[model samples]
Target: MSKSELDEIINRSLELRKKYHELELTHHGSHWSVEEDALAFLTDAGLVGRNIMSQQERWPKAHSASELEHKIGESIWWLIVLADRSGMDVKAALENFLSKTEKLLDQ
Candidate 1:
């Protein structure tokens, strides 16, 4: 995907995150802490791993393709949210990471 497309996705995720925080505040009187967000992301990440294992037939519990796809998308959304909560621009961070990895591999 183009950089603009990726940035758009990140922006949308951030927008949704703001709405979610509003809900959290209404229901619980505060937004989740960054650590809580990290934990939630980790939980989804674990589900993604489980889904992959199921796809490989290594896991006893079976997960549908849709479930795996949803989890993967959710994990990515969490990454964007995490980056924002940590006061970083997700797009810049992603570009920096990719560039550094490419340069290192080229060496």
Candidate 2:
């Protein structure tokens, strides 16, 4: 997807949260809470662990491959929103980290 499409997805998620609040009368009633965020991370970690277990089992395929991708995408979206809430620019932070890593590797 293009940058514009990604932006639209982010905007749509924001709108969905707004609608959720309208119906629930509470902030994050239908959105991600800290516990939910931790659970998401744990879920993704479990997927990764399962993938490792599959490798150990000598399986030729991964279980929940598509779901794993979706989870990863969701994690990224959550990170982006969290960064925005924390007043940080995700793109800038990524660029800075990459640059710093390159410099450290060169030393």
Candidate 3:
């Protein structure tokens, strides 16, 4: 995807996260802490892994493809939200990681 497209996705993800934060405040009296957010992301990540295992017949319980797709998307969204919560520029972090990994592998 283009840089602009990625930026737009990041912007929208944060915007939606802000809305969720507000909802949490309204319902629970406070937004989730960073650790809480990380745990939530981990929960979804585990579900993604479980879904993959099910597809491989390693997991006893099965989840539909659509369910797995939704979890995958949610996992990515959670990562974006988590980065923002941690005061990170997700795009820059990703670029740096890719550049460093590529250079390391090339060496």
lDDT of each: 0.95, 0.66, 0.93
Best by TM-score: 3
Quote the positional error of residue 72 for candidate 3 in Å.
1.0
Model 3, TM vs. native: 0.94
Query: Residue 63 error for model 2, in Å?
Result: 1.0
Worst 10 residues of 2 by lDDT: 27-36
Evaluated at residue 97, the lDDT of candidate 2 is: 95
lDDT of 3 by residue, 1-107 (tens): 99999999999999998999999999999999999999999999999999999988988986589989999999999999998989999998899999999999999
Off by over 4 Å in 3: none
Q: Count the backbone clashes (under 3 Å) in each candidate.
A: 0, 0, 0
Residue 2 of model 3: what lDDT? 96
Candidate 2 global TM-score? 0.59
Model 2, 1-107: lDDT tens per residue?
A: 77788678767755754564476557545655656555765776676666656656755665666665676666666666655656777667777999999999999
Task: Give the TM-scores of the predictions, in the order they appear.
Answer: 0.92, 0.59, 0.94
Residue 88's lDDT in candidate 3: 95
Candidate RMSDs in Å, in order, are: 1.1, 4.3, 1.0
lDDT over C-alpha atoms for residue 103 of model 2: 100
lDDT-sorted candidate list, best first: 1, 3, 2
Task: Give the winner by lDDT.
Answer: 1
